[model samples]
Each structure stands twice: as C-alpha cells, then as structure tokens.
Target: MDVFEHIQSAKGPSLFLLPEWQNRCHLLTAGFTGRSGGVSESPYTSLNMGLHVGDMDETVIKNRQLVSDALDWPFEAWTCAEQVHGNRVQRVTEEERGSGRETLANVIKGCDAIITNVPNVLLVSYYADCVPLYFYDPVHHAIALAHAGWKGTVQQIAQETILAMAEAYGSRPQELVAAIGPSIGICCYEVDGPVIGQVTLLLEKLGCSDDSADTMLELSDNGRANLNLKEINRQIMIKAGILPIHIELTQWCTGCRRDLFYSHRMEGGSTGRMASWIGIRER
Candidate 1:
C-alpha cells in the first residue's frame, strides 16, 4: 500500500497525507501538497507553495494559508529554509517559528534540511521534482523536512539530517521513522555527464554491489542513466542507521503525474512547487 494517501477536499488544499503517522500520534501531522485548490494563476495554476517561484508573493502566501487551514496548523508556525541543495541541516527552535512564511527574508539560510523538537513548529520545504525527505523521532517528539535533489542526495543529505537530529535532539537513527516523498522516479529522471559520475561515486561510497547500483541507476546507450533518487536516499538512510522497515518510500512520480504535481523537467523549468510538511503539537 502507498504510504502517502491522496486527499482532495471540496473546501481545502489538495494533500498527500501520511495517515499511519498521523494515526500513530494524534498530535502529529505529516504530508505533501498537490497542485490544486489554490488561488495562483496559470503555470502556477492554483496551489503553488513556493514564494520564490514566479508566482505572485501574495498568491503564494494565500496558497500556503490554504494548506495551513487544511492541516489545521497555525500559519504562524510554518517555518521553512532556503534550500541550497547542500547537506547542511538547520535546527529550528521556538524563536525561528514562522520564518519564511510570507516572504523570503528571515528564512533559514543555505540548508536543505530543517529539524525541530519544538512543539507546533511546522517545518516545510518546497519541491517540484526534487525528493522530499522526512524524519520523525517519536521518542523525542521531533520532526524534520529535507529537500534533496540529485545534488543533495550525492552529498548524503539523508545521513546529515540523521546525524544532526542525533546531535541536537538525541534522536537515535534506528528509532527514527523516515519517509521519502514523491519526486521524479527513474522512469522519467534521465541524466548524463557529471550527474552520472557523481551518482556512481555515491553508490560506490555506499558500498552498493553492481546489482544494487544497477537498480538505482540504469545506464542507457546514449550515455544517460535513469536515476531512482528515492531508492538511493532510502539506501543512504539505511546506511546512516535508520531501519529499512521504518522508512516509507512513496511511488508517486512528479514527472509522471504532472496533472497532480508540478514537474520542473516535464514543464520546461517554468513551474510552481509543492510542499512537504511535518510537525507535532504540544498536548
């Protein structure tokens, strides 16, 4: 069964929810947004969660508010980072809550991963086709949102987030539940040149066998390879000590489902973004 359940409500933002996680902890909410039920115009055409995109700032903020309304989360708690496709993980605290909600100023800087144990602080990251990595430590009541493109994946952002959580919140990797959200799958993610070289080096560093590497990167005759970033990140999570069974990998490919998602590759680089969010409320 798919870990993220798609839900479209008549009066709210479209969302892909992590129902099992929500059910396991009534105070927790975790999910990704879809490209519908917002107020942005064409290209963005409704729900565009990214303020940095060409979408009007007001429209993007309204769309974000719609999501906050749907999630029943306070808009003041929507914290985000300016993702730089790097492995740096920022630890969000109570004072940093609500940064980057309405504007880019005061946003957490140059980090792909943001984690927080502070209750009611929602950590969000934007994506069109890049992978969204989620980490939750129920024992510590902490959660994280990481944006990983192929660059961040090669930098081992997953492992970096795990280590940051351990150092900041005393979260054990084995005890943490993680999720790899929707992104371009191998079916539609083809790459050549340095991307292929970097992925090959990463796989080797992960000690993946030839068969494992083959599964992650299928080389074509034209010097391009189809890359499965979700799988690669899953393996990285396992290597970083997260239990394989505890990690949920979604099969929804943004490239394949452009009707429901924004595909940067398929959409010719002019597209809006979806958001992946995770938070816990104080009881």
Candidate 2:
C-alpha cells in the first residue's frame, strides 16, 4: 500500500503512518527514501532527485518528472536553494522556480527555508543528516519548507519561517499544521560537546522543557549525544505558539533505514538525495 504512486514498478522507503498525507487528496507533501527507486546505478541507485550529485542529468530530470507527474504537478514549477546552511529564509514566489543549478547559477542568494502562498510550486531540499520541517496553514492556503542542520536549528529557522508567514500572509500559528519529515533521529545522530551545549542553550532560550515533552535522549559510542531532531523541532514549534495537535513527526529514521533513504554519512559523497516538498494549489 506504500508503493510509489508514480510507477507501476516502483516502491519507496518503508513508510510510517503517513496516512495523514495519503488520505488528503489536497495535502501537498511527502518524504523519506532508501535504496529502492531511481535510475542512478550503484551509489545513486534508483530514485535520486538531486541534479548536482553526479548522476546523469537526464536521469535526475526523469526522476523529477516522475515525482511531478505523481503529484499531478508540472515538472517546471519546483524550487530549491543551493543550501548554504545559513539562517536566511527566502520567500519564494512565482519567479524563483528552478533557480538552483550548480553551486551558484540558479541558486537563491542565501537561504535555508522557503515559503509561498502560490500554488503548485513544490519546494525541494536535500538532506542526509539535517532535519526537514514543513509548515502548512490551510486557513491562508500557504506553506513553508525548511532545512535545519545544527547551525540553522540554533538560529531557529523553523520559528523564523513561522513568523515570516505570519507577517507576509497573515497565517496564524494555531492554524499551521507542521510535519517533521524523516531525518537522522536519536539512534544515529551522534554529536560532540560544543553542539550539545549550543543546542541546550538554544532550547532554553526557546523556552522548551522536558516537562512538556516526553522525548528521549541517548549517548552514542563516541560519547556524543544522540538527539531526536523531530522532537527538537516540535518543541520549537510549540514555543512559537503553534498548536501541538497540528504537528506530525514522521516516526521514521533515515540512518536506520539506509536501504530506503540516502544518508550522506552512510553513502559517502557519491550518493543522491531524497527531496521533501510541499506546496499550495491555485484556487
């Protein structure tokens, strides 16, 4: 039942209770991957959507086209950043589609998150270790997508994007339904002392509490702390005043499901990326 909606012969990573996504005919979003689909050989394997990952351009293009077709979107309406991993959040419009090509040429000036009230403009971001966050305020019919690595998370990109939507589109935080996409979870995210300290400090500044959340933490073999990024972002969303019930964290971990996802740490630099995208449709 979790088969790829695009090809009769395709399958995706083991899905985990994405029924909210599957049931909503108008719900514009999806994510999670492993080694099953795509046309790239060996390293890239089957469903690699990244154009810059040394996969054949046409192959990547085809995978993209397949995704677009699966979602009933035009292939050309997709947007992505060069991903500088900064705190900048770009407000995507009708004009920014296809701006990422190379490390520069079609890339957005500098940004880590993207938002739009525009319909059918799917936003894509690559990830192997960082977290993917999605925002949708159906009341305003708008959506925002973000990538938060350690640096961007400390800068509170999720909170920033929510505020941006509030300012530009009058989207209320309570009306926003957020989804924490599949990412490196506590089981595989081992980090050193400084990052732990920084994350802790930021969590405090954001007013997150262990009391309100039933989250778990672990220490890796190297003594680095393993974190549940989905939970971390969920707490940030709560602090931003978003309704708790409206948030969904995909109960899947990329590193654990390496057969279904593209992990940078797992596949080295030669692997491709699985893209997470969300968008509104023109009413």
Candidate 3:
C-alpha cells in the first residue's frame, strides 16, 4: 500500500502524511510537502521549504510556517540540517530545537542525517529528486530524517542514521520502522559513467549479483543507466537490520510528478525543495 497519504486541503501547505506511523503513535506527526499552497514566485512557485536556494528568506519561512500550522506544530519546533550529501549524522537535543528553520546560518552544519529522541523537536531535511529517508524506533521514541542523494547513498547514510540512533538512544534496528519517501525513480533518473561506477562498487559491497544489480542500476544504450535510488535505500535499510515488513516505500517520483513536487534535475537545477519531517509532539 502507498503509505504517504496526500491530504488535499484548501489552505496552508499540501502535505503527504505517513498515516500508519501516526496511527501507531498518536503524538507523532510525519510527512512530506508538495509544491502547491505557498507564497514563493516561479521556480520556487509555491510551498518551497528550503531557505538556502535563493528564495526570499521570509517567503521560505512563511512557507515553512504554513507546514507547521497545518501539522498543528509550533513553528518553534521545526528543526533542520544543511545537507552536505555525506554520511554524518547529528544527534539533536532540546537545545537544537528550531535550528535552521528560517535560515541556513543556523542550520545543523555538514550533516545529511539528523536523529533525535527529544520530544517537541521536529526533525526536517530538504530534498529535490534525491530520496528522503525516514526512521523511527518506537522502543526508544526516537525518530530521524536523512537526505540521500547518490553521494550520500553510496556513503550509506541510511546505515549511518541507524547506527547513530542505536548509539544515541539504544534503538535496535529490528525494532525500527523506516520509510523511503518521494524521490526520483529509475524511469526518470538516468545517470552517467561516474555515478554508475560508484553505484557499481556499492552494489558489489551489498553482494548484489549482476542480475540483481541491473534492476537497481540498469545500463542503457546511451552510455548511461537508470538508477533506482529509492530501492537502493530500501535495500540499505534492510541490510542495516531494519525488518522488511517495517519499512514503507513510496512510489511518488519527484522527477515524474513535477506538478506535485519540485525536481531539481527535471527543472534544470532552478527549483524549490520539499521537506520530509518527523516529530513527537510535546506531552
């Protein structure tokens, strides 16, 4: 089943909520944003959640505030990280609540993954075409968000987030529930030789046979291959011990759904960003 439920509303940000997780944990709210229902101009158009992408800072804040209001979360709880396409994971605390919500100046620096057991601190990461990785450990009440572009995927950001959660909150991978949110899919994501080379190395490390690897990275006649990033991240999550049954994978591809999402590659790099967020409300 498609777990990212799209909520069509007349006001505020249009969002995709993870209903299963919310049903399991009443206080938890998690989802991704769409491109409609915001104040930004073209390129950013509307509902742009990224602050560093040349959008008016205040306009970006307004868009973010809309998301917070729609979630009924205080804008003060919106925390973020400056994704550097690396495997570094930052363990957020109460003090880090609301960091980088409005500007890149205070964003969690050089981190692609952010994990926290701290309540009332909403963890957010921006994305455009790249995969948005979600992790939750009900056993420890810990939730995390990771940004996985090809570089981060090759570096195993998913595993890094899992290991960080285990070290910080004693979250066992077996007890963790994960989700791969909207991103580019194999049909719309073609890659060149350099990317194929790195992905080849990672596939070998994952012990994928040529046939299986072909499904994840299929070679084409044009000296390029289509890469299924979402699937690769799902495999990484499983390799890290997250149960297959506990993971939810979304079929919405950013590159394919340009009307509903902002695709950097599809839009030729002049695009806004959607946000993937997860947080436990303050009790």
Best by lDDT: 1
In terms of lDDT, model 3 sits at: 0.93
The 0-to-1 C-alpha lDDT of every candidate, in the order given, reads: 0.94, 0.72, 0.93
lDDT of 2 at 130: 80
**Residue 182, candidate 2: alpha-carbon lDDT:** 73
**Which 10-residue span in candidate 3 carries the lowest summed lDDT?**
5-14
Q: Model 2 TM-score?
A: 0.86
**Cα-lDDT of candidate 2:** 0.72
Query: lDDT of model 1 at residue 195?
Result: 98
Candidate 3 displacement at residue 36 in angstroms: 0.3
Give the winner by lDDT: 1 or 3: 1
Identify the leading candidate in terms of TM-score. Answer: 1
lDDT of 1 by residue, 64-136 (tens): 9999999898999999999988999999999999999999998988999999999999999999999999999
